[model samples]
Target chain A: MKYDCDACGPELGAYLLGESSDETRREVDAHLAACTACRDELERERALRTALGDLPTATCPGAVTARILAVVDAEYAATRRRNRRLRGVGLAGGLLAATLAAVLFLRPGAALRGASAEHYTPEQVATARHELIQTLTLTARVLDQAGRSTLVDVFNDQLPSAVEGSLRPLDDPTRGG
Target chain B: MTNETFHELLATHRDRVFTQALFSLRERRDAEDVTQEAFLRLWRQGDHLPADRVAPWLAHVTRNLCIDQTRRRSAARRHLGVADADAVDGLVAAAGGPDDPFAGLDLDDRQRRLLDALQTLPAETRTVMLMHYGDGTKLADIADAMGKSLAAVKVQVHRARQRLRLVLGTADGVSEQRGSA
Candidate 1:
């Protein structure tokens, strides 16, 4: 190839390391054969490398290796933990879905209307409608146990208030009577 | 290789690895951390590593880690506040004539002094020099690592060396050489 213009000086270090491509190595060899300056440069470089090697190395402490091993172990453990959690979530979700399916199919009539309708005043019907809408709204947003727990707590705290408010207006709209 | 063999190899090459890391990081603790991280990564990828390429592989990994560390540090609060004198010197000394034993000098003091003279070169040239001599990285690898062009790396190498010679001349109380890069 175009040996004269193509650069080999950049590959000199790799050449010394014997990591250069065969073609580049050949060019370097030929160049060294003819170029005394490049040859001298290579010698100084080699000597300098030896000297650099001779320069003192930092003393790694006893804990360094231990610390590294510990980190690797910890990472491995964490990955396993995450996988197990995901699997547990999947299993729980499957069981919940199956339970819901059984409830719907095994006893559809009763399960669908456990709190059956009975006689009620307009205020009671209004309260029931408000409670039903509120419960449905809460259940619709409950995506997880944690969120469902919070939703249940919100309904528990609000149903009584909502029911009271719904009938209070029918009984007496006045703030104080 | 088995763990024992790997550890033995590491123990054998620890000095070089640590030295390279130290020079790259310029901090003792950082060097140790990088060394361990590099080896740990090596171990994690051990199955893929061919045995013959271990030392150079370690060097290459350590060098890349150092470069990454430097880049990361350069971004955040300076993890290594220490200026990189080694990178400058690596390229400075990486390509001397193969026959000349460091400018034909037998004295270690003169050699050390000459190297120290590299400090005065322009910062960019010094970096190129360090990659060559300090890390023994090929010019192309140096260019790749430093994100510089081959021509740029060559010019930097040539200029850095020429400047280093002049600086050494000045350091040795001699006149600046009238030579070109």
Candidate 2:
């Protein structure tokens, strides 16, 4: 196959880099043989590659390497700590859940006995109900008194100043006159 | 690979990654930061990565970090009037180093011209070129890392070579004329 320079121009790097397939290499070779421009271009590419490839390998500073390792270490440690905390929390939660489940399943009557009517007789139940009502009524009275006290304080704080301002004239002429 | 082998790989490629970042970002501190980020990323993902993909993976991550840094630098420049003094100082310092790869080599006139010309290329082009030539990374790998098509990378590389050749050729002609005189 005949090779055109325009078509073959882009393949030059591939050819020099040995990335070109055999067939493409042959095509490039044929094109290069027939074209001086491409030939010169190829030589220049070769020179550039050689010059660039010959650049000495540079090493990162020792301190920079140490810093990188330190950062990685710190980050890894943090990750481990986070994972461990999560695991601890998860394990504790699991244990607690499991214990509760086991107790419910094994002593099925524990929940019932705590709130069961069997634990209290009729007289004791009536007395307990009466005590509960009394406690609730006292609590309600205390809350109502607290609310009234707050309102009284607010009114007392504002009333004297409000009355004084209302009785006083807006434009006092005694001092100015 | 085990921790030992991973460390070995890190030691082996440390300079390559640093040099690539240094050239790409044009600042030593930024390069170091990018290098650290890349290695840290590698360590985190190392277990899931294939052995062969390690080097290119580092290259890809480092380049991305450099690009991000460049964007940040530009933004900071715009908003805070922050200039890249570090980049200039880094190049100047690197120019004097006896062990600096770009400077230390006993290159000929043409090679030196090529090196100087390389600095003048766009950051992305110079990066791809350097990674390919300096580290011997494949174009396809560079493309994959940079999220570019292979063809695009090749084109950038081609343009870089073409520019360097022209610059070197011009320098060669002037030197030849002087020699003849």
Number of the top-ranking candidate, with lDDT as the measure:
2
Model 1 lDDT per residue over A1-177, tens place: 555423655455567878667878898899888877676666544654554444444455667767765766676666556665565455445544654555445433333345445534565556545544543333333224322233344346433444454445434654111
For all predictions in the order shown, the interface RMSD in Å is: 7.5, 5.7
Poorest 10 consecutive residues by lDDT, candidate 1 chain B: B172-181
- Which ten residues in a row are the worst by lDDT in model 2 chain A? A168-177
With a 3 Å backbone cut-off (N, CA, C), the pairs that clash in candidate 2 are none
Q: Name model 2 segments beyond 4 Å from true.
A: A109-177, B1-6, B25-27, B44-48, B67-112, B172-181
Evaluate candidate 1 and give its CAPRI docking class based on DockQ.
Answer: incorrect
User: Best candidate per DockQ, number?
Assistant: 2
For residue B9, give model 2's deviation from the true position in Å: 3.7
How much lDDT does candidate 1 score? 0.57
Candidate 1 chain A: worst 10 consecutive residues by lDDT?
Answer: A139-148
- My TM-score estimates for the predictions, one after another, are 0.46, 0.66
